[model samples]
Target: MNKDDAELARFNALARDFWDPKGPMKPLHMLNPLRIDWIENQYGSLVDAEVLDIGCGGGLAAEAMAARGAVVTGLDGADKLLKAAQLHADDHQIQVDYQLGMAEDWAAANPGRYELVTCLEMLEHVPDPESVIAAISHALAPGGTAVLSTLNRTARGFLLGIVAAEYLLKWVEPGTHTYRKFIKPSELAEMCRRHGLEIKAVTGVRLNPLRALQPQPFELTQNDLAVNYFMSVRKPL
Candidate 1:
């Protein structure tokens, strides 16, 4: 497995409560709508699109894509998280093909297989993020769009993304992220370019402290890329 075992173990422990709104996965739940909407805006309608979500922990993003009429496949390395995702899908009657595996292997087997590829919040946890980007490039068909989100490697990112989010606010688990693994936007863009993908858009994500009491608190912007951000890329047609 080309994964960090310790990181996988930490996420596995949250499988049981992955879907709870007030639980440790609250940030994901809150940001999901924005993510989905942004994806749709970048790739147009997901209806009938072949979508693959790499590192689809607990299937939050997978289930959402399915609900939007896309044929969704979710790939993850965590067995317990996959089980929780399966159980949740069964309960909701959502048709998401959840698989347990690594993105590189899956990409090798199914090259150019999907119309849209999503690898949100997965890069920072992986052992080699560039390899994952390569896999994403391989799995996407000509003109296909790939969307990714991650924290930037910066002091602001550490202050807000890790310290405030993990320690002060208690928004996510304490060890949810490591500052060193966070990839800067320029580095991410360069990686995507090397993999034959064109950058379409970039957006910064920020949580509104005033909306802390609300179900959704995060917003996407064009100005700030110092911390958490999203990038959209497309394979050449």
Candidate 2:
């Protein structure tokens, strides 16, 4: 049962210091607030909403959502990462159910469980992303919201996400990504549609490379989505 074993191993190997802001996961730490802000602006404050954070490596987004009053569950397929998430949540007194298992399998066993489903920077790493999307649809309650972010399959994506981030800047480990796995916005919209999710907004996620170094905020935009992008989807009532 290898649902992307390489990816699981990759994150597992980096799990110990996943919550450290100065570690390999620092990029995610910087990107998380922007993700949370966009979610709040689009989905409204999650007070009392049932939320699921898929591929929730170290509880960054999960804790943020819990802070906004959402009853949250953080799911990851890797054991080490799940432990890191649990420890981080415990240290902050954040109440998030940290679970370790495949998202597809977990969603199969827990259908219609969440009012909001978030899969961020994760779809690209899976061997069959459509399976993950279908699983998320099952996990989401009818009329729930699904927000996903991933690398775009574009020239700029190859240059920036791969060339610049992994190689030149060394912000991420070498061979952390493959260009073929990146998803285009159009492809993602179609995949969501097939799973009963209506596309609402597609926004470009931009963080100045300097932010990864100097520490600063990022931006979301509809103007450009050549590298990284986020899309909000909804299950029809």
Best by TM-score: 1
| lDDT values, one for every candidate | 0.95, 0.87
What tens digits encode model 2's per-residue C-alpha lDDT throughout 1-237?
526888889989998888888788767887888889998877888999899999888788999999899999999888998898888888888899999878888898999988899999989988989888999999999888999999999999999899988888777888889999999999999999998899989999876656556675467778889989989999888
After superposition, which runs of candidate 1 have C-alpha atoms over 4 Å from their true positions? none
Candidate 2 residue-pair clash tally:
0
Q: Name the weakest run of 10 consecutive residues (lDDT summed) in model 1.
A: 207-216
Per-model TM-score, in order, reads 0.98, 0.95
- Which stretches of model 2 miss by more than 4 angstroms? 209-213
lDDT of 1 by residue, 150-224 (tens): 999999999998998899989898989999999999999999999999999999998777987788888888999
Indicate the TM-score of model 2: 0.95
**lDDT score of model 1?**
0.95
Best by lDDT: 1
